[model samples]
Target: VMGLIFAKLWSLFCNQEHKVIIVGLDNAGKTTILYQFLMNEVVHTSPTIGSNVEEIVVKNTHFLMWDIGGQESLRSSWNTYYSNTEFIILVVDSIDRERLAITKEELYRMLAHEDLRKAAVLIFANKQDMKGCMTAAEISKYLTLSSIKDHPWHIQSCCALTGEGLCQGLEWMTSRIGVR
Candidate 1:
């Protein structure tokens, strides 16, 4: 159809495509955030066993987002997709104070991979709606983000359940990608 042809042409002309991966420990709300971005509504999600991928368009830019399972057992598979990724969205359960150290360890290990050296990282300090949740600054400090000299990094507070701050995070990411 003519409409389909125009759509493809528009994509070819003005669409900027980027690959991004979402990662975090199990129960960190990665899937919830993805659904929020896609549907603009809260979605109930189960633990991801492997991965779920979706394409999103924001500000006329196209993004291929991969939501990978974050269980300890699936961590090893993360590196497999790092090579082509332009950005990494690391989710954290801001109220899980007890697991901050574990999250830090896993995050550092992921950053150390050679393929991720140039990828921009956006850490989502999720669950800000909960009581006693850590602020973005606190999470950044605990994650030792200052030491991440290899890539451009940022931390944003978000509550996936309520869809607060999700668009701002994506806007930051698109800016980092050099797309207007």
Candidate 2:
């Protein structure tokens, strides 16, 4: 019995890997967050027309994350990447107040989709360092996170450019991975 527990832990810590998809509206900083996890440094980025894939290890769990493009034209392709995804990282521009409604709409749409039904959600209220930016609580309210009952969800305030609050968010992800 003790051997079985050891084997389980070994498999989980050494071999287990999760699929995560980073998505959001165009210019919401998804790529920046992805790079922050990988290199721990901000990368100069332009609008993503396709997707970026990378492996990231946090708290001993391996996560193969895909940072997908968020332009209106590319949003339709998001579903193709949802099949094996265990986590959906939604990066929102905290200062982009005018687009909050659109972001909320996209979030609910993904949550309702059959492919993503089982995935946990992490909403990053990014750009927190800027003045007049929405707080994490405010973004949660705007996105109606309380209305979501089917999946585990969390909202974290972060400054992707500066790589702040990013670790705490990932720590939450790694913690969730062990619960089930």
Candidate 3:
């Protein structure tokens, strides 16, 4: 009975909630990463039309994550959901070197939005399992992350298929947001 009471009291005070959005070019594995977090397994995904909102608990903190569609036509609508975002996950297909310029452009545009100026940014360099994929450091340089000063940012190399580096990224995000 005493232990149960302590558990109840701990739950009352230990949970924190945060809002995060995952944005990137199409086929960057945002949905796969989301599934990995939610289901602990990979789920085959088609291109998202608008967005997928889901809640996940990491380190005892509840995170409401919005996985937004990254198609060129849908990119313009991303800002509409940024108003209350606390963290931004920008996934990049490390093997898609040809489209890095487009990714860079879209990323900078999102960062320029007033609502996200104070949000923590986590760049997931996805597809690291693919041959000749860029490393997280290279992606950061390609994206010119050094130029971003308004938000705390991190670049994590991740392979959604095998679930490598994903938790570290979330842990980094939670740390940046002061959750842990």
- The lDDT leader among the candidates is 2
Better of 1 and 2 by TM-score: 2
Candidate 2 achieves a global lDDT of 0.93
lDDT of 3 by residue, 114-169 (tens): 99878888999999999999999999998999998877889999999999999999
Question: Model 3, which residues run further than 4 Å from truth?
Answer: 1-13
TM-score of 2: 0.93
Residue by residue across 59-145, what tens digits does model 1's lDDT show? 887889999999989998989888778999999999999989989988888888888877899999999999999999999988989
User: Candidate 1: deviation at residue 121, Å?
Assistant: 0.4
Give the number of the best model, judged by TM-score.
Answer: 2
Total colliding residue pairs, candidate 1:
0
Looking at candidate 3, what is the lDDT of residue 127?
A: 95
Model 1 misplaced stretches (Cα beyond 4 Å):
1-13
Question: What lDDT would candidate 1 get against the real structure?
Answer: 0.90
Model 2, span 94-146: residue lDDT tens: 99999999899889889989999889999999999999999999999888899
**TM values, all candidates:** 0.90, 0.93, 0.91
Q: Give the candidates in order of TM-score, highest first.
A: 2, 3, 1
Clashing pairs in 3: none
